[model samples]
Target: MSLEKKDEHDHEGWMEERDLTAVEERYLAILMWLDKRLRLVDYLELLEDMYYKVNLQMPKSHTEQYGLDNKFWYWYPLYALGSFSTLAYLIAAVSGALLGFYYAPAAAASAGDPTVAYTSVTSIMVDLNFGYMLRSIHRWSAQVMTAAVFLHMLRVYFTGAYKEPRELNWIIGIVLISMTMVFGYTGYLLPWNQLSYWAGQIGVEMALSIPLAGEWVAQLMFGGFTLTQATLQRMYILHVFFLPFLVTALIAVHIGIVWMQGIAEPH
Candidate 1:
């Protein structure tokens, strides 16, 4: 309870009186300091609760409750698809952030001239050192993330991991998949190349095909019926800014839920 350090000898005197050795003294001193500042004791208690709750749901282990210990299940490899997808997502996010330093989203084009956005991409590939490899890593990581997510969903579906208490996680997984697709689509539009241009035109027409608020939807999403500066800007913001924060938050929640529920192992 006495927090006064008074002098350099005070901590040593207190430790000597308690019969604590050098390492024990230092460790306890640091621990107590952190406990006072951060309330480490409370969080440690919560962690203790989670550990027992997740590991010992009944009088036995999770594997015993799920009856996996007695079986020779060949599906353990597939169980890691969720983590693999998360790895791919992290790779893509980091690489994309590095690429953001060189990317431009402006779309002002002249006769027989590439737009500013397209020129920036060209500069990144040609002028910036190692830019080609960075772009390649970003593109391939995104593709890998997409594929891994699909395989993860299939595994969840076929294994019935979407049942009962995990229903919320299942729903969250669906939302994550949709967001991943949208993230890819928006990234596809950032280059301002011919392919990206035509693809975005298709997106615009699709939005316009919606029954009632077609024009409004197009205006909101694509910034008009045509691919313009606004469209490029919108895609840039969604892909680079908004979706990162949204997806990261959802992934955190998804992992937190998993931590609470424990994994659905084989039976």
Candidate 2:
């Protein structure tokens, strides 16, 4: 017999001698077959090592340290606000991307007539299948994220999580909340309806109210001081391109800090 045949024969005999269940035999056979081709065992061992290294460094909460049996969700709802807001932001981003495929940003219209932007939004709400539900999901998710982020800040403040080594993260959180509001405001103007038009006008006024960089801010954001096609285009670009990238990067940094520092348990 060849050496390979001898090894295979020995493997079969070993399995038979174990008195294993039928399921166990099948599972071992499959595992050995794949391990021969994939070297999965080496990767598994590496992952196990990494798990232990990371697990050892993480700080235990007071409940965990004291062997208390209290569940986190039932005992401490505020601890979850950060995660909840992140979930809402992700939902809004996905729904908004889907809606983008059908939305028009054109605002060309004569006086008292609906622009192409408004008409496209109306079509989505009334004509397209499941469009209303999709829009509702995006809108509601944005609102929920806003509320959750606000409450998260309040929780951090009340818990003193913003003190000491966390002051930098607190500043980042403030920036995140401001950017969240800007995200909602920019999306709100995409429809170019009467409400959106007025909202854009108000944004223009607010931008122009700045002392040193008023006109520059207004021009950069709303495009030349009027709620025209340029304004809608700028808003669409910011909503789709600029804000998403910036906010996503900020969120990654924020989460990285939290991972390094561990959750700040309230006193």
Candidate 3:
């Protein structure tokens, strides 16, 4: 190999070809100097390669397989339920995160009249600026998500979209629906108002009715077969922390499967 002086290489000629501004010239000069020392561009290319390699590959739908000529295959209204539920889930997540800043999970106030949890809810609804709207949005989004998920399941069932290779997603859908119900229930109990209190009591009783692990389920879930500070804490944790991660993961899988199977052509 011939010994070559790198200073003989003409980077200025390369820059001159593009007619860069003074600012761009300085930026490129600094970048080139740093890149010569640290090889940043090589690392960036590696990252870009990895990104493209790992990118999701969505499956083609029936319409795409044949042609855009098959417009009848891509019905918008009923097929939109999946996307609608996803949108509602996003709305609930954002509003719930904002509501979390002001929420306390204690079951009772110092005076023991209204529970601390209930007081916090009242404060969010009545005192904090735009808190009512924030909470309303959260509540409504959750409700809408639930309704949309249920309707989506019904749509899939009636259309026989759950058959053949789609059975796994159908099972996952059942789990997601159950998790959604639990999400709502946990959030419902967080307020610790009279209705919530009775609701928790009912939950305890229902858990205790399970044959084998009845008492264990009651203790684990309801905090010793009775509603208390622990109950509220548990509910808050499940609602804000556990269920979010679980539901979000299931949602990602559900969407991924749909992307693969392409919304099971209407039967």
Candidate 4:
């Protein structure tokens, strides 16, 4: 028997035998080189198998499975409300990030006057280029997201889509809705205008109205009893950093669970 290994199974030889084009030959050569050293082909084959298996097991759409044609549904628009809300959230996040670049949380510079934070917002809206439009887009998107989320909840409730297997998703939806409101409320205070100031005041009052830990909640959230620099800073951080991360993670998990559970069909 020969001590040297045979080159009969050489990938280059195989490519030549198959009469591959120049590009295909180069691609195959590199792929074979990588596969020989890394055994990537086996993993790729496993992934492909899994992909096909998942596709095969995927559930058919209700209309397609039931062969229901020409059956226009009234609630079909409501079905898309969740997706619309998600889109709005994404828009708000992007615009809010851009707005954050121009906004200042300092309220000390003009203490008796409007406030540094308020002035910063005025500058953004009136002085900076396209800043007004950016803020408008962010505000509108946030409003739209809140509205969509509310409607989505109502749709889910009336449709009885929160039964049995979907109860966890329903709870997740509720959490997301609450987070969405928080996101809006926090962002609303970043401007530090009269409206923003009063809203923050109301928030403090609401927190203080809670039973035993009311004062603690107010302190933790608003950073004391008054809407001072601390309050603006806290709101800015919540709007631009904390709530964004938390809400985004929760939204992703909520959507992922919904995807896995599949859309509930009307009976």
Candidate 5:
């Protein structure tokens, strides 16, 4: 028999010796099949290594270092804001992705009927099943994320957690907050409603007031000095494509740094 056949025969023999149940035997067979193609074992080993490094190298917090052993602490709840914001962000991302399955970005219209974007949104809310609930969850989660992130920033500032060793993370946090605002603004304009149109106008003016780069900023961000189809397209791209990847990457780095350095405690 060939080496391949020999190996397969050996695997079968090993399994038969174990007297495995039907489910266990099928599971092993599938595991071997996938492992042959995917090299999943190597990745699992790497993940295991990373898990140990995280657990072993993570520094103790002030309370842990001194063994305060207090049942409750005032600042403990404030420390949870960062995690709470992360949870909210995850909820928004998942709901937004589901919403994307039914949303359209086009803004074509005859005169003053309704843009394709608005119609799609209305259809989702009124026609599609459970669509309203999904949209509400996405909107509320985004709002909660914004509030939580703002409060987290304030907590960091008041606690002096932005100093020295954590300065880079602090800067990253600021960038994240700014991007969160951008995310909210882009999503707000997606519906193409009356309020969104005026909001887009405000954004155009703000972009155009940026000293030397005003016109360039306005053109790049809003596609022109006016709010047209291009403006909506730009907002859609920024909200769905650019911002999510950038923000998620930044968040991973931010959380990884915090994990490595340990959460900064108030002095």
Candidate 6:
């Protein structure tokens, strides 16, 4: 209980008294060192208590309590949608990182010539080994993640899982889905091809259409009133830097809330 460190021999004495093995002694030594500086032991004890509390027996689910396992099994696939989305997101993230090493986001157009970004993409597809498949996988995974997230939202809506205690999670889900769209849009522009160029133009127009903050949004997002190198640069930073951190943090919080609240069951 004392905050003051007892004699070094006291910890040693305690360990000796416990007849700890070599591994246990080393572990205790490291833990005590860390505890002295960080008081990690307190947090560890709190987590241990929470673990036991969570393990305490609880009433069974409505299906389990009512002996309706057969009916529950029919609906199990819906419950897996969230997990499917998470898996797709992870796959996209890994593949995107790999593709980023080879991607360029320049948009300096040359007459009858590919832009630097487009040429880089062409090189990846035509020259780099496995680059075509890697890019394809990344693109497909991103599309899959978007679809899975949409379906997951629909599942949550129809099941009433977003009601009552889950309203905050519902809101977070909305933000995450919007962010997913933004992620896709930004990545789509990184190639800076004809399609990407027009998409960036549309984004600028959309931003410029907002009533009061129109020009400001345009300047901040597209980097000018027109699609150019600055636009590509902004999209690249947003896709590779900003959104990844924001979305990952939001996903952790979203899942943490669900873990804390327990999954809502359709009764």
Give the candidate number with the greatest lDDT: 5
lDDT by residue (tens digit), candidate 1, 1-267 = 778756764655777678777899879889878987999999999999999888874555567767776552567667888898899999998899999999889999745589989988988999999999999999999998999999999989987889999999999999999999999999999998889999999999999999999999999999988889999999999998899999999999998999888887766
Candidate 4's C-alpha lDDT? 0.87
Off by over 4 Å in 5: 1-60, 69-72, 110-112
Those runs of model 2 whose alpha carbons end farther than 4 Å from true positions after fitting are 1-52, 55-59, 66-75, 110-112
Cα displacement (Å) at residue 82, model 5: 0.9
The residue-by-residue lDDT of candidate 5 on 14-70, one tens digit each, is: 998798999999999999899889998999999999899878965566777776546
lDDT of each: 0.89, 0.89, 0.89, 0.87, 0.92, 0.90
Off by over 4 Å in 4: 1-49, 55-59, 69-74
| Candidate 5, number of clashes | 0
Q: Which residue pairs does candidate 4 place in steric collision?
A: none
Q: lDDT per residue, candidate 4, 56-144, as tens digits?
A: 86667876688653342656788899999999998988898898888889977675577888888899999999999999999999999
How does model 6 score by TM-score?
0.83
lDDT of 3 by residue, 1-267 (tens): 457755546887788878899999999999899999999999999999989978968567565666743454466677899999999999999999999999999986757589788888999999999999999999999999999999999888888889999999999999999999999999989878888999999999999999999999988877788888988888899999999999999999999998866767643
- Model 4: how far is 46 from its true place, Å? 6.4
Candidate 3 clashes between residue pairs 3 or more apart in a chain or in different chains: none
lDDT of 2 by residue, 1-267 (tens): 555655654777888879899899999999889988999999999999999997887566776886653654454778889999999999999999999988989998635588888888888999999999999999999999999999999989887899888988999999999999999999999988778889999999999999999999999999988777899999999999999999999999999999887777643
lDDT of each residue in 107-162, candidate 6, tens digit only: 77655588888988989999999999999999999998999999999999999999
Per-candidate TM-scores read 0.77, 0.76, 0.75, 0.79, 0.77, 0.83
Write down the worst ten-residue block by lDDT for model 3: 67-76
Q: What's the CA error at residue 162 for candidate 4, in Å?
A: 1.3
Candidate 1: C-alpha lDDT: 0.89
Q: For all the candidates, what are their Cα RMSDs to the real structure? A: 6.7, 7.2, 6.2, 4.7, 7.3, 5.0
Off by over 4 Å in 3: 1-61, 64-74
Model with the higher lDDT, candidate 2 or 6? 6
